[model samples]
Target: MTKELLLAAFIISVGLCVAGAGTHFYQWRLRQQAMLRYDGATVFASMGNLVMSFFCGPYIMLQMGWSQEGGASVNMGSALLSALVAFGWAFLTGLLIVGLYVAVRS
Candidate 1:
């Protein structure tokens, strides 16, 4: 991989992470305002979602064959498909983590 590719990946990954973190923080703040109990499950679910999104987005891009050139060589259709897959994966991963936590707590 060229420096360009590496830089692109890094920028994409960091952007995703920051966005995810911001969303998590907003949710937490909302919960706090509601006087809801802040527990491990809440933290785990939020963090899980962020992590899933952060990694999966770029992964989808890569899996779709997106390269440094950013052109037809990399199938645009495949990129969309990979993005959809990543979306599902991220949602399911968050749900799965919550389920496991509930099971263990019970």
Candidate 2:
């Protein structure tokens, strides 16, 4: 049961990370074409935050699991909540990156 939960969390984290990375990369491409000198580090920093969130979200969710007599189960709400929180954190980090980009650009 623990193994199943771990597997599920890992899969979820990977999905989130992939989605986040793709989005960041797309943004980078757009910026690269529009601006003469865009900081590549912004995209890398956002990706790093996404990676951190991938690990963080699952770890938080895993802690919310409860053990029972026959099997172990985790609350669906908790999992979603953790994912939301992690995504929010990453989003905020992305925003910060954007702000930094703007600051440096000017």
Candidate 3:
């Protein structure tokens, strides 16, 4: 891939991770303020947040084998690595955001 293409991909992947982290933070904060209470709308919104955060990864890597003779095949190793990287990115982002919020509130 060209340098530009790689750079674009990196930006898109990181953006998705950031968005997921933000949504996860929103959901967590909402629930925390509610004191473990769950409303219907909140439940649905939280589920959406979970899905968005869960799938924030290098999904294009999973499609690398799509053009093969057989149907789309996934490389387990790549999938696992992508997941780990995405999770780490989101986790770090979340921690940074929460830490800053706490620091500012103190």
Candidate 4:
């Protein structure tokens, strides 16, 4: 069970990181074409937060598990909740990136 959980965590984190890197790279391309703009720090910070989130996600899910009520099986809700929280955090970081882009372009 523990090994399965560790595997899930590793897969989820790495998957999110890969997806984030791709998204950021696409955004960078758009900025290059003048479709968007942000100072380097903002763009880098946004990307950095994704990396940080990738590392932090599983710890958070497992932490929530401690208080959850799934006796013989994992509570899918906790996983979903953790995913939402993590993505919410990432969304907030994205907002900062958007604000920076607007600040520069406007």
Candidate 5:
């Protein structure tokens, strides 16, 4: 693959992993604060924030005209699609991590 593609993939992977870790940490914090077992509402809130941040990061990048080619290009349609994809990936990653944690705890 091209260097640009590799770089893009690496960045996106890192973003998703960070988002998942953030969700896990947030859930843990909530559980600690409440001094109770993990619940659906807490998980949902954590996941929602995680996904929002994930998309927001990329959205901001797009807004600032940050492109893989290192040039300023405003493509609203493409940026919106990218934001949606990032959000979905982050949401899925968070859900998978939470599911695994619940599975292990059970």
Candidate 6:
């Protein structure tokens, strides 16, 4: 592949990895907060977090317009937006998984 194509792929790959890691980190933070009120279900949460982070990555990248970036910026605003969206997606997915679990268990 040409250098430019390789460079573009590298940037987008880095961005997606960062977004996934950010989401996973957010999940850890949520677990910490949840621990304050209640305990247990760590395994479930971890599994759900993994699934959410893996599945939500593409959506997050699309949200960041990684494909359509036309050479996107490495600026703070873009980075922040990407992280924010990733965290939000992860959080929402976690909630959904928990809710489903509760509903089924009841």
**Which model scores highest in lDDT?**
6
lDDT of 1: 0.49
lDDT, candidate 1, 1-106, per-residue tens: 6997665555544544444454456457655321112234687876655554443443433344344334547666766776666445445444454456679999
lDDT tens readout by residue for model 5, 1-106: 6997665555556556665455456557656322112234687866655554553343333333324433555566666776676655645554555556679999
After superposition, candidate 6 runs with Cα above 4 Å error = 1-59, 62-73
Q: Each model's C-alpha lDDT?
A: 0.49, 0.49, 0.49, 0.52, 0.52, 0.53
TM-score comparison, 2 vs 6, better candidate: 6
TM-score of each: 0.32, 0.33, 0.37, 0.34, 0.36, 0.34
TM-score for candidate 1, residues paired by index: 0.32
lDDT of 2 by residue, 7-90 (tens): 555555554554456545645765531111323468986665555444333333333333222346656666667667655544
lDDT of 3 by residue, 23-90 (tens): 45655866641112223468787675455444432232223322243446656666676566654554
- Once superposed on the true structure, which residue ranges of model 2 sit more than 4 Å away at CA? 1-74
Superposition TM-score, candidate 2 onto the true structure: 0.33
For candidate 5, the per-residue lDDT at 93 reads 51
Task: Give the clashing residue pairs of candidate 4, or none.
Answer: none
Lowest lDDT 10-residue stretch of candidate 4: 31-40
Candidate 3: stretches off by over 4 Å: 1-18, 21-71
Once fitted onto the true fold, the runs of candidate 5 whose alpha carbons sit more than 4 angstroms away are 1-71
> What is the C-alpha lDDT profile of model 4 across 20-93, one tens digit per residue?
56455645765532112223568786665555444344344334544557476667877677667755544454
Q: Over the stretch 15-47, how does candidate 6's per-residue lDDT look in tens digits?
A: 455555655565586763111122237978667
Q: How much is the lDDT of residue 92 in candidate 5?
A: 54
lDDT of the structure predicted as candidate 4 = 0.52
